[model samples]
Target: MSQGKSLEHLKIVLTDIELATENFAEKYCIGSGGYGKVYKAQLEHFDSSNWSSKEGVNKYDLPKRRSTVAIKHIFNPEGKEGFITEIETLSSCKHDNIISLLGFCDEGPDHMILIYELASRGSLENYFESDDKMTYLTWVQRIKICLDIAHGLKYIHTNTDQDKQKIIHRDIKSANILLGDNWEAKIADFGLSKIHPADQEASTLNTHTIAGTNVYLDPEYKKYGRLNKKSDIYSFGVVLFEILTGRLAYDRIYTKVNKKGIAPIARHHFENGTLIEIIDHKIKEEAYGHVFALSKGPNKDSLDIFSEIAYRCLVETQAQRPTIDDVIHKLKKALQAQEKSQKENFKMSLEDIKSATQNFSDDNIVGRGSFGNVYKGVASHANGHTIIAAKRLDRRLFGHGETEYFRELDIPLKYKHENVIRLVGYCDDEIEKIILHEFASRGRLDGYLSDASLTWVMRLKICIDIASGLNFLHATDVNQEVVIHRDIKSSNILLFDDWKAKIAGFGLSLVCPVNKDIDYVIDDAAGTIGYSDPLYSKTHFLTKESDIFSLGAVLFDILCGKQSSIKLDDEHVFLPFLAKNRYQVGKLDELVFEGIKEQVDLQSFVTYARIAYQCLHHKRERRPKAGEVVIQLKRALEFKVS
Candidate 1:
């Protein structure tokens, strides 16, 4: 169909669009491009009684109710050709993953406009800018989004329609991928899209102008001036990296480290066995068991497969890269594997757990809290007999027994990590409430900190382990919930036979739903006095940084071999304050326990002390993320081996 004919078929009145957009208000504009700005507007219900239908009119019909729409107002005359091309391309194609062109307005050449379905969730670019929003996308969600883009691209590449022809979306960056409600990804911005001529023998289209974002642009296309479906594949590979790393394709930090775009850096790591090193720490921790495994086939982890596909797509030679169809197949298979691995058996009968603990015998009790007693038990199941910790809540002591029991159960069931305490099962009987956890054979870290036999290497390992566990809890990728361990004292750090640390105690933990923002307001501060964040106590606002503060105290306790709340004669000196003060005056080495001080490397000791000092900063924003702390601690641990 001709451009004029297509415009007539659209049947969108210029006056109606003007009224809907309030004369193209700047406040209503959601985004802008080289040609024009895209404004979000609500159009009045379209009445069939007042409209006439042509052959193509029914296809572009609007809903009866006031519906949200995006109106692109083309201002530049040079861009009019691009606008017409977009209309011609989108009007011919109809895929669920492709953005729908609702209507068009061509009142005059200067006042040209095209209407499209509103993507309420905005573009994928917006989510990457902030840590809180990035947490909303899990490994599954990220894979699903990639699959959606692949399906749309597949449709464009393989369309057999004579009139439509094969098209290449020249700009396939994260900013062009619009997300609707539930984060359904749709490919948008067809301004730079190129249609391949049917008569041409070669699929590549030679263009004088270099279009698309530099970071995501294919190296082959940039150097050779050749554009094809593989260009889209290359750009999509960058998006895959963004999904995995939670970093922009051209992030300054990544560019500085690699001296090129993220693709080269990713490829280098992919060739090496250290791809896991560059993966977003949040997803890396969540995918620990499944991703890092060397096994293949049904036992093979999905993350490995996904990374391989991404690597294939990012090959320097365009022809060597996998097609969109191949990407779709691999992504689907990886998603299935991931889903299977995530399925867990977290339920247990009250009788089974009770029998395991000998009916909560006083002699079996391992530890006690204000509202509960933890008893060691042996439970036999399909996985064989395993030692378990049965936390039996005392209803008489705690007013909200059922709530606390379920809260403790809910968190553990949602997360699975080596450093995290696993919830084996739960027993919620009317008379008794109990939660079963994997028992730590060596008991709490506090119990063995002053044992005298513990070496500097062992202490460093424990500190690293604790940091890893805290990083997992504070990660946004795990259910998009930032878990703040309000009470992160030394007693809460449990140890296994191999001296591995597992963080426990979830009764006072607060789950800050990250879909909104980071800081959450609570009615009252709930934590041990010395270990609690001073900022949280004063402001009544809880955040993941508060947990970092508590971890700082634990780090000091590990170093000095003393509790945070211990009395110091006339006035009690909080461990965080004492450590920070001593470290500033170069007295940190003086506070180190005599047992490990002789073996501690001066450089490693100073690094550890610096991390703890930063965590205890008065300003929460100045504190490093738990993941950053993990990296620093790991580096400090390496000093022992050296």
Candidate 2:
């Protein structure tokens, strides 16, 4: 058969039209979706040398070597020719992170094919969803994937010289992201993409399209039919949540409640920092502080970088979120911080960790929390590991006690989350719940907030991690209800080995909707003094924002540190007018020690302190939600990260 007639006689688009050419080879099949099947093809063009380089090629390898292309032959009888045009325009708008288009064949109306550069590793969906596949992506690589998507979006939305018009990649999902062999991410499948005029500030298309994978859809766009940069950001945020947690956008178990499955769970993780709990079990161990320390850090710089970038990208509000350009800048800064810190803190092998913990000396007791006590156990498990934390939970809380105490002890089990302290195992046979978690030898936020040992960047990072944990909690669903972590204070927020804060002490956590009032009776007032939400304490209704208020108190504590609740005349040297009655008035700043006060940025410091002030408002309604607090904090700390 002639080459031209052979291609025509294939009858590829129609089911009934038998191919005069060879049947579609099984090996060439890339993917099959509802619309049609995608076949891998080779199109020889400009540099045939790029094709002929493979002299040891057979028929099978012929197509593989000749400028690899993916041909999507549509079998949808209703598929319109406009689909081809849309694909053509999309193919023209090239991006370094976007799949390149060799060409497309639109010979006849019914038989249309869209071609794209082949990605050997296939779709991101396969990596995330397949049970036997690799789920363990290093935190650094995850950050890079985030940057790749951000760069692609920036390219599309900013309409750089290559793109004549600003493009909206309306469908930004893991499935649409293709992984190259080099692990570079390429944004693909722009079937639902829309082009907006460069001159227009905001324009809407796809009035009838209303398309997106359920898990990654932007709530704002889904509800309002709006599409913009924010929509893309929201979608990317969902993707980020998925990457961090290793959870699919949707899963069968969640389908009972709604078809749009994992969004609620994703939102929950985003708010509570329980994200690590939901991470793929295969990769859960890798998500902890120790693994992070061993692989990505010795200096704790990468934790700061990851926390800042991930936290910023997942901001609930689109307006408050950073643009892709801003995201790239922050990511680059994080990378640099990681590089700089590596020089200061050498990577510790697991053997080091084993040796450090083997001694288990009392002198190694570094810090402790409400649920457990931490010892600076040498990293006994492996070499090159640094001082590890052995968190032995109080067994008394679980054994031979009143049923209520046992129940209370079980609460922490429910919080088996990364940010909250990892529960390695227990020494229950000897005592109560002797849980071992990674130790943060660097001390709690309390130590650094007041010590002057932490830099402004360090303090900001601590606060961001705390916020992330809270955000995850407030957003997660527990007992089919959201959890309101009534206690969010400095002491309750523990610092990890890397000095990143993780929220702990869930004993005070109340399942949401059951007890909204903050003022309700507690065994002891649910939170630390001065940090409790005055409104919640009085009203007993603690909303999600109440936690925000408590976080605000922590922010204030971060700013003022030991100065948070000092009495004026206790010889503790309180700020002037800091006495109980006069302190709430004005002139409080004048009382601050000149030495401590000069180093702080009154504007920025006040902004943070004021957020705490609002959180402590006499009214619960006034306190911002955890999401809002996250946004505010990100904005306040933007300069530091930048």
- Which candidate comes out best when scored by TM-score? 1
Ten consecutive residues with minimal summed lDDT in candidate 1? Answer: 288-297
CA error at residue 325 for candidate 1, angstroms:
19
lDDT by residue (1-642, candidate 1, tens digit) is 265554455557888887987888888898887777989987743433234444455534633434578888999998877787898888767776898787777777778888888887889988888888887777777787888889889889887676568889989989889886546688998988998865678988888889988889999999989999999999999999888888888889787776557999899899998887778766754531222122222224788889999999999899999988899889988887775655333446777877898988999999998758999998875436888899988878455566667668877766556787887767665777788888899999888777778888888899888888888777623223578879899998999999999888877887776445778899988899889999999999998999999999999999888888666677878978888888899888888888888888977887788988999999998897886687678667876678
What lDDT score belongs to each candidate, Candidate 1 first? 0.80, 0.57
Provide the TM-score for each candidate, comma-separated.
Answer: 0.53, 0.46
lDDT of 2 by residue, 152-189 (tens): 78878886664277878778988888876435577887
The C-alpha RMSD of each candidate to the native structure, in angstroms, is 19.6, 22.2
Give the poorly placed runs of model 2, Cα more than 4 Å off. 1-21, 46-65, 203-208, 253-259, 280-284, 287-318, 333-642
Q: Which prediction has the highest lDDT against the true structure?
A: 1
